[model samples]
Structures are given as structure tokens and as C-alpha cells.
Target: MPFAGTSPHEDYTAAVERVAGQALGVLMDAGGAVVPAGFAVADLHAAQTRDPDADLPGLRVLGSDALAPHVLRGTPVPSDRAEAAARAFAVFPPDAVGASPDTAWIVTWRDWATARTLTRCGLALDVPAPGDGAQVADATSWQTWSVRMAQLSSLALPGLDGPIHAAAREGAEALSRGLVRSMLRRDYRTAARIARWIAWVAADGVAVPLDLAPLLRHVRVFGGGSTRTVLDTRIAQHVTGLEGS
Candidate 1:
């Protein structure tokens, strides 16, 4: 049963949990790295939640930190995680609703796993756990989030509009990390591919429609940590066509 509470923070915590829980469910089905190996979608859904107890309504205050512990390892929820998470979400409630929250409730739940991570480590250390903040800019933990923001925005892709492009264009001038460099150059052929599925989903109207094998293959060729270079003119052309069409 959802926690019945009076405080806004409690309501928010319950809401975050519901959102993250749903997202995680979808992610589990999609077979993302977010979940532990061998854990099936049903298993995650059925898995009993542990730690952070969910007893304290104040946990909502920690915001992203509140949900970090449940999702990723090595991330501990700080005692102040609740306050930090709350503040983070308060900054952006729209995004606080996980990606496609209405349709991908399971994915949202999986994404909420970050709350566990935040609870374990505390908030001052990492501003936003993965997936907690929609845009990289919302991450107060790392200034480099701006770099990730750039990579997500630019690339001359069609239908992939918004601040991401602007961030990438601007970030290229000011932030020149190796990966950032490749992304700024539209050198996707060599850039590390983090969320090709998300990209595909974002670009295409269908859910997980693309055969991610090729993208993964290219990612392997690019190497996990290699600096990316996005010279996929074909993809660029497609994006251009999308924009023009």
C-alpha cells in the first residue's frame, strides 16, 4: 500500500516511488544495465524493497539522493539525502516525472532505483543520481553534466530538438572533453553510445522498435570509454530530412 501521509514531502516521496518503480519495470523488460544480472522484469517487480525503510516521509526531501540506493551500487544515501533529493525535484517537477512516465511506468520504477543509491551516499556528494534528473544540466553533483547535456542535445538529429542541441553547441566551445569533442563534431560513429535505445525511442514513435544490435556493435567498435566522433552523415541526413519534412 502507498504510504498515507499528510506532508507534501510524503506525497512527493510516494509519487517519486511510484514513478521510479514504473520506469524501472519497463527498463527491466528492455534489459538495460540498470538492473542486476539474472533479475527478470517480474522478479524486480516482485522483489521486496529493502533499506531506507520507506517509513520516513522526510526522505522525499533528499530528492534524487533518496532514490539512489535502490538502483545503483557504490552510491550511498546520505543522511541528508532526503533534503537534497527534494530540493532537486522541486527545481524541476516535470522532469521528476520519469521519461514517458504514463506509458513506461515500469521503466520509471527502475529509474527510481537511484533513490536507493542517494539514500546510501548522502546528497552533497552527487547532486542527481542517474535518470533522476531528465536533463544533465539539473545535476548539481557534477559540472561535467553540462558535457553530457551537450552530447544529448546536438548531433543534427531530426525530431531530437530542444536545449540539448544548444547545450552541445555551446558546450563544444567551452567544454572540450574528448567524448564531448566527438559529440560536438557529430562524430557519432566513434562516440561512446550510452542510450541508443533512448535515442531510437526518442527519434522514432515506436517503443524499442529499432534492432539495437548494430548500434551496440558500433558502440563496441567505439570502445566503452573512447572519445566519440559523430560522422554518421547518413543519420545526419535522415535527421535533416526529418526536420525538413
Candidate 2:
């Protein structure tokens, strides 16, 4: 069945899972290099080239700026292009979120991933913290922040000390709470995504209340040639023998 029921929540969860699964396929095919074709780089380029104050409805100009860096990770791109993308990402105005909440959230979400990518490449970015003090007023917002936290924790970069670490732990708590809420609402697809993030965070050595160890093992066995493989490798590389209880 495409979805379990006719509920809107089920429909939404099914859509999100479809997108996530497609992304996984892209990641696997790219071997961790390049974003999926679904991101529409040409559209993003047009948006970025337009005037910031232009009256463009629903256009997320900073989308490519924030995402390109992560997409190019472990891939060969020219230094000038990489620098340009990073520069655009770095100078993204915080107030831009006021223009479009949805677009802004996406930009910020990818900004976090961009930071992780830069760090992985032995580079640094002066980007602002994502969702700092933001309230999770709904499931959508919670999922947005949860995915960002999952990306951040998965990096497990060395010398990552201080307030960022504290913030990650706090985000972990919020994600756990959100996970329970999603499950209670019978949003199993969302719950599964959250569970994957929980496993990712646990693999990164932060203590999460949920024990997805069995699930993780199952993924390792059957999640071959997919994003699950990527996550498993990351966990094995950086986790240092830590696993959820």
C-alpha cells in the first residue's frame, strides 16, 4: 500500500518518506559526492542571481548557497566555485527568515549541514547557529530541527567543544520528546526518521533515552548500498565503541 490510511498525517508521512528514500538513492549513487538531481540546481542558481529584494514569490534564493557545499562534499569541484558557495552561505542574513518561514527553515537547516561539510574538509565557516532558541511548536518544525541535529551529531568532528556540544545534547532531548510525540500520534514514518536520527546521535556518543541498537543492527544487515551504509560507516568510524543502551 502507498500509505496505511487516508489520514492527512499519513499522507504527509508517506510523502516525506518518499523524498527521504529518493535522497538515499541519490546519495548512494553519488558515493557521497553531489546532491540529488531533485534539488534543481538551475532554479537555485536563478534565484541566487536575482536581486535579494526582488518580488519573487516562494523563491528560496539561499537554498543553493546553503546546500551546495554539502552537496559537493568529498567531490572534486573548483576552488573558486567552492569558495563562492561558501561565501554566499556565510553571508546569509538572519532576517531573511522573516520573508518566508518555510524557505528560511530550509536554508538554515542546510546551513547546519554546510558547516559539518566544511569541518569535514578541514575548513571552517562563521555561520550562525541554526534554530537557536527556536520553539518546536509543531511536528513540522520539530522534524526540521531534528534532522539538523542529526546531521550535526553525525559529524562527530574532533575538537568540537563547548556550547555547541551543550546545544547538541539539548537538541537531542528535544528530538527524543518529539519522537515520542510522533509515535503517540501514530506517525510511524516520522517516528522512524526520528529513530534513525536517534541512532545516529547515539552512534556519535551522546546519550539518548531510546535504545535503537537492535534497529541499528538490522539496518547494518539489510540497509546495504544506501544512506544507511553511509550512516553506519560514520558511526563505526567516529563512535569509538559507544552504542545506545
Least accurate 10 contiguous residues by lDDT in model 1: 225-234
In terms of lDDT, model 2 sits at 0.43
Whole-model lDDT per candidate: 0.35, 0.43
lDDT (10s digit) by residue, model 2, range 164-239:
3455555677778766775566544344445545654565677787656554444344432233233333333223
Compute the lDDT of residue 93 as modeled in candidate 1: 50
**lDDT of model 2, residue 132:** 48
TM-score of each: 0.25, 0.40
RMSD of each: 15.6, 10.4
Off by over 4 Å in 2: 1-26, 30-81, 87-92, 99-113, 119-164, 167-174, 184-197, 206-245
Model 1 has how many clashing residue pairs? 71
In model 2, the Cα lDDT at residue 106 comes to: 40
Superposition TM-score, candidate 1 onto the true structure:
0.25
Q: Per-residue lDDT of 151-177 in model 1, one digit per residue for the tens? A: 332222332233434344333323334
